[model samples]
Target: MTDSLGQQKPVNIKALLQACRSKEETFKALVTLSKTLPRLSAEKKTEENKVKGCESAVWLVVEESHGIRHFKADSDAKLMRGVLVAILSLVEGKMLADIQKMDLKAELAELNLSSYLTSSRTNGVLAILNKINTV
Candidate 1:
């Protein structure tokens, strides 16, 4: 898969899962990627759209253009922001069918996010997936 920037993007789920498994590298990668994402606007993030069950308030907005989905998200907590970035990096610019087919629970487990995350944060991850499904 390729992005709007003409860069070849990782489409294989296993490769992305492996990338997220490296704690140090994935953390750095997330932070760097987050810096490049467009900032979420206040209008784009309404109370109703805020991800529920999250320890920190998180907002995710999904937009589809030319048959590809693009995600933009923000969070009050830095770590949550990194987690969102990591997840979004894997999904964004992909077809909805591909996103829907992904085994997110297994992928998260492979990344060991469940072990590192709190119960609320784990729920927040599910909430993100729910939102994606809705889109």
Candidate 2:
């Protein structure tokens, strides 16, 4: 669905965050979303644009128009792809400053994902933020 600004709106981040806070719900949602994402294929993969610090290979592409930022990402890992979807859904088309100000760590913590994420996956998340910041 589109928001008032006519940009695609995400599945509600607040609701997702809350669900993540509940162990059973978070696991269920993650599993469901992860299953839904298409797996990365050799033909679809790009080398140069791949995120550097992730344990699992991840590629993120960004586009901006009229002050709105859009992102497309793919990952070799299903769970990571789901995480990317969750993050992108929250920030896509949002103002840069607002995106920058977002307490992603806190939000993830609320979902109990903060502690479970690998250092590499955390870095991948930061890489996404850096990409958005640059746009």
Candidate 3:
């Protein structure tokens, strides 16, 4: 991925997840990007999109148009929002078929991301993955 001038585009969280240097740095980056996820509209924040099994309420909305999935999410907790952003970074704009082929748990494990989270929060991430993959 590049710009018109052929400069390498900044690697996204998906790439960051693949990096081996410092998992803490990658988690920090996820947290930073988490702040960028826009708040879901009142109309969009419904039970249908809400994720379960988390300490906080997390809502994820998956929409597909022309075979590409658009992921939108929000949470009352910052770290959970980071989780949502990380999830969205992996799959947003990707085709459903492509997303289905992804092994998110392994990717997250590669970063040792679970170490930064509680077991239940980790399970929440799994639930988020289930929601995204099922869509």
What are the candidates' C-alpha RMSDs?
Answer: 3.6, 3.8, 4.4
Ten residues in a row with the worst lDDT in model 2? 1-10
RMSD of 1: 3.6
Candidates 2 and 3 compared: the better one by TM-score is 3
Score candidate 2 by TM-score against the native: 0.72
Ranking 1 against 3 by TM-score, winner: 3
Please report the candidate that would top TM-score against the real structure. Answer: 3
Residue range 38-95, candidate 3, lDDT tens digits: 8889898898888888678999888888998877789988777876766676677789
Tens digits of lDDT, candidate 1, 1-135: 446633225443335435665666666654654454556788978986688878888998888899888877888777677677657766878889998899877666655455447787788898888888776
- List, residue by residue over 1-135, the lDDT tens digit for candidate 2: 545433234556446646565656666666665554445456546766677777788887666778777666778777787677666767777677777898866655554555447787788787766765665
Instruction: For each candidate, give its TM-score against the true structure.
Output: 0.74, 0.72, 0.79
The lDDT ranking, best first, is 3, 1, 2
Q: Candidate 3 regions off by >4 Å?
A: 1-10, 14-28
* Alpha carbon lDDT at 8, candidate 1: 27
lDDT of each: 0.70, 0.66, 0.73
lDDT: which candidate is best? 3
Local distance difference test, candidate 2: 0.66
